[model samples]
Target: MSLLLDTDNSAKPPVTTFGPDFPFDYDRWISHPAGLGRLPDDQLGQEVAVIGAGLAGIVAGHELMKLGFKPVIYESSRMGGRLRSEPFSGADGVFAELGGMRFPVSSTGLYHYIGQVGIETKPFPNPLDEATPSTLIDLESEQFYVEGAGHGALPPLLREVSEAWSGALEGGADFTALQDAVRKRDIPALKAIWNKLVPLWDERTFYDFVASSPSFAQKSFRHREVFGQVGFGTGGWDSDFPNSMLEILRVVVTAQDEGQRMMVGGAEQLPRRLWHLAPTTLAHWPAGTSLASLHAGAPRPGVTRIARDEAGGGIAITDRWGDTRRYKAAIVTCHSWLLTTHIDCDESLFSQKLWMALDRTRYMQSAKTFVMVDKPFWTERDETTGRYKMSMTLTDRITRGTYLFDNGPDKPSVICLSYSWMSDAMKVLPLDAERRVRLMLGALQKVYPGVDIASHIIGEPITVSWESDPNFLGAFKGALPGHYRYNRQMFCHFMQDSLPPAERGLFLAGDGVSFTPGWAEGAVQTALNTVWGVLHQFGGKTLAENPGPGDVFDAIAPVDLPA
Candidate 1:
């Protein structure tokens, strides 16, 4: 069922990620004419070690450089971490989005950087989205075709499922009111509804909420099964069914799953551009100064160890080559699991409680297979039924969701043959790209018997199982039931004033540490928080006009549950 509430009022302010947890307007904070903030003169040229060259690290490094600090960025692998866009060999700039493809319009924090870098975006062709020509649903060998968008286009069973989901949200969580509060930026009301839900659902799973809700309980088991496979807004959330209900509510309430767009060229361009682009309005840096210039056009080697410098008064970072450097402050943008598994981090850097939270943080698995095609052959119409030859396919087979990317009419297009999560992802973990492609083609052959997807493919196929990557042990964080405290500890780590002296200068920022994990906006928001934390560490304060997240954190911090 459509979880989005019809609360759009043009006169009202647009809905942004103004938080159900920490309702700080990071978009406004960063976009303020006064700028993010100025650093103390003494700290202007001081180096800050930023680990990982992902979206969070690049954003933090970019902002820190603008504040006149020399941010030394360390990359373990590629530059754009999970915003990976790998180009097919011998293709004309066609990219297969390996990670972080769809971005919601409500993610103002992420868009701020996209706008800054002059990146372009178009509505992603999600299943049954207006941007998509048609959508095919295949469940239990039965196939259904939806020709358009909205609930009206869905089959009766699918529509009933959608309505039930909408009803469940309204009845259980006051969905309309909570979303209205979010759109209107009503902090009190937003907190009133969401804080109440946090305590209720933090200990429950998404599956539990769906099964027990009056709306779903009244329906047949098949209805719930369909909802899991062909979910509202996006395709198949069954993988997340075992996760905390709070996580699902956060996504629905903030519209993080709807009105999504895909970055043109590739999402990786955002970070790469931010690295090379010199902001016109920076504090201590000159006009031409950029992150690339400071780092001599490449980031430092991967970080091997992180510890407090006994000789110096701040954190010390060691590179893979055994080179060590000390920084007055440091920002770690890597996955939390990497802190324990990949990096030799000092045990004293964090309290036992915080360490427990980090060690216990859970991540989800994801896999995607993409192939460059000769043309937009899917656009061809079938003579018998007058339907598009192929469509955005959602199935329960090995290939859970298949997306089609039409570069243009004649130009080479791309198709994501299979996009699966959790168990589905693990099924092909040990397989190579060709084998995965073969299996996906076999599944699609059953759904579209008349068309041959294999014939249209050009260039080599690209596939990735993020769980297999050593640098990133999994796709992103997926908080489990009863893990609210762990999330709170990680999300609030950027506020270091109350932390012990040993952990004061070290900060964490990434999607994994955010309340809404698996979203670029979370990474952006947490990165902005890290920027504010670094400013505070240097004894700097934001201008009165633009008080940073730290300035008003106590008033709007997340609800703290009893230990």
Candidate 2:
């Protein structure tokens, strides 16, 4: 992970997710000793509806509960939402991360919670990462191997592609200056550089940025194609080619793609622990009280409808079983599209403009296939070749990226045979888990002609196409060109003082509502913003020393573009 070096002083701050948009210090705000805020005595123990038990809902509920408000969490699906980790049948702890897997160290907001939950993390084995034994890149029926760390280890073509990508970023996006400001947490400088780029790039696509760059323009078409297939950091970003350039820049500037780690057991543990953990420092409730204890060991059933409580002067949430509960305020942490397709929401809850933004929000599709192996056999070196049997593979085949996980010599290992996005993902959307595995195995066999991957398989393979799941609709938001207004509208929805009475009591919080989507840090940041909004609605204020996001929102709010 890169450190923020101070040119004048010796102290170096860690790079955090301090925004290029809002520029709020969420990590500092949450870590403050003074605590988030305090609720009015009358508002203590007042039930607040929190829809969706995902990381956002869980984080918001945990914080709100600490401040003496009773946050009733409603979950239609599992507790972790997209952080789903399905264990292999008959295995001790080996599982497949069907949702989010890799998390960057720069995601301080998320790390705070991961630390809170006491979950262990280790470096993820991305292609070309030091943590990986080796990486095999296969395209057009040709193979190249990268041993050890750094781009210099790659083959000539791949090294050229990597250098060209860097040059393109430097030439087109002022990469160094922007990342330096991000590393230093220079809010003013970050905003100045980023705000200018927003207007210039909001209407452009990531592909457009790459194609038009002087660096890439000088390179051959083959270089651009290879760059797309074996992109820097994680892997192939070609799926995001059509997305707004601003979306890609946000990830690059913040270093979201670097120094990634995976949860020890599963990403789901973070939210699950938060739900059951009874904070040592809490108000209005007993010392042993927990979110689980409040709801009798589980969250309330999935909410089917959300409408204004006309008589109660708040919001009313109706569960799938027809049980309706009223609350002084409500937070919606589910996918924005669900508000239109899954839930029956009141039309007057938001303005037509806000509705347009919500409707315009786009979600991306993703698919993953995994299997538990009998052992870490991939580590075994071939006698003749003097190379590991199977390396983490990235290709232009049906399986875009293949990842391997080694628990230990004694424990069973796991392999993500195929992790594809967009069109690649849709190819196996209708296929069963076994079929998906077969397809991926066939593709991998071409890359590793000698290795028998199926022989070591110990359990039934697990697969997920997030788009097929009604609860999720899609994997995560991928903003298109000209969708900045929609993102800003969702992101700033927490600051609702200027809104009409009907929209005041309801709020939105999740990665989709954040500038950096598909990252847990974004989910945590937005959840904190939701907490501040709920605290403010209940006449609560932060301590003088520790001001909340809502307290200083206007000053550092995201830049606005023409309507």
Candidate 3:
């Protein structure tokens, strides 16, 4: 029989229940000194609770354990929210990233974590610098022009857009200006750049805003503009989305300035290794208990009540059956908007301004499609053209996005890979894998020639629509122009109204709070900085705020995503 620790000091009264899968292996858990089981429940005082088992929460819980703090993780779904990989049995038993692909060197902590876990990284393909001649097509004009490889492969209009974008940044137009303009509903600024800014929000439809723009209308060669928007909105003919053309453009430009890097085996390898690094911690971490309720009493300074059942010292929590347990301090890592919609938090507990800001921010649209081909068709070039390019940039005279990764880098004989971005338009499509593949292939045939892309031999495709995922409605929170300023302080002020300062002791971590705000590195940084922040609270260690979120978010290094 395992010894039970007292849980009397629980601020939030819990409705406890016990079942077959309740209490876990107490003996094994005892070996971990920093583990939850080792902490006397009376001293630990109900323990810190982390909701959402995604990387954000997982990493946060791990850091807490390292700091002699035990955290009970509550997840409504299986692990790895939007970061996942699919395994395909082929010649080399290869795998492909159906979710996230690469992380650059700029993510120093992420690289370190990968290295600490023995995950290997590989050099990204440098086709952009490979001197391969490729054709740059005007999607609107159907007028094709060829560039002799390298950085010059971009179409004339695209080159202009890039130059103009760079000029805008160099001229002191920062994210703050854009965000402020959006917040103030600065009609003039928005209207001045309405041609560029409206498309960022309106790119979900099949219509091509770039082609419709007065700028494109004046040009005799605007006919191909629809394809440009198709290319841009969809992250190119073959990409994945709900990410606007503007967002995709930002990624590309950032990649060009920052460069691309990836794990040699696959992206999943990193997280898988991290899970194994602290095997005892992950294997014994408590989960599977549904937070049946969030009982909110009268609000107190810096505190709120979040009640739960079938957790704590009860069942094993593997099969969804468990002993009901309770926790007081919980930091939810799921969608904030969803939190407001589904669960009730103390309205008086959250600041009125923060609540209003959260209400105004729209949900992000995210989807992924993975296509497996017998071979990388892009590498199989035209014998007549002698071009060995594996991918091309899909752009209108305006926006650009979409990418093809070589899933066969280690196994060329078996699986090939491609992805497309359709932004919010994917929401209207059937969410099945077949329809996704057809849509991707249909888009692909529209851009490349018959022998080049059309009628290309391929295998089955797998698509994951994150918006429909039970645990998460979207990939991440969309920080509108001014939301960053408004919500940036939410982390510090979230617990201002709670009692006993329970939340001050509880840590907050998530990409939504990060400078980058939407990428994997931002998620990692959230965890890293979270640990640093908590340690600072304990008078342990601290991080320099010199870079600041805005600078870090806009920081550009070299990237290898190709031009």
TM-scores, all candidates, are 0.98, 0.97, 0.62
lDDT of 1 by residue, 274-380 (tens): 99989887777788999999999999999999999988779999999999999888999999999999999999999999999999999999999999999999999
Candidate 2's residue-wise lDDT over 1-563, tens digit each? 22121123225455667898889889888888889988999889998999999999999999999999999999998999999989988987888999999999889989988998799999999988889999999999899987787755778888777777888787777877887788788888888888899999999999999999887898999989988898888988899999999999889778888789999999999999999999988989999888999889999999999999999889999999999999989999999899999999998999889999999999999999999998999888999899899999999999999999999885799999999999999999999999999999999999899999999988798999999999998999999999999899999999989998888899999999999999999999999999999999999989999999988887888999988
Q: Which whole-number lDDT from 0 to 100 does residue 32 have in model 2? A: 89
How far is 365's C-alpha from truth in model 1 (Å)?
A: 0.4
Top-scoring candidate (TM-score): 1
Q: What is the alpha-carbon lDDT for the whole of candidate 2?
A: 0.90
Who wins the lDDT comparison? 1
Candidate 2 minimal-lDDT segment of 10 residues:
1-10
Candidate 1 deviant stretches above 4 angstroms:
1-12
Models ranked on lDDT? 1, 2, 3
Candidate 1's TM-score: 0.98
- How well is each residue in 206-287 modelled by candidate 3, as lDDT tens digits? 1233334443444544333332343321124322232333433333322322334656667766544454345334222344
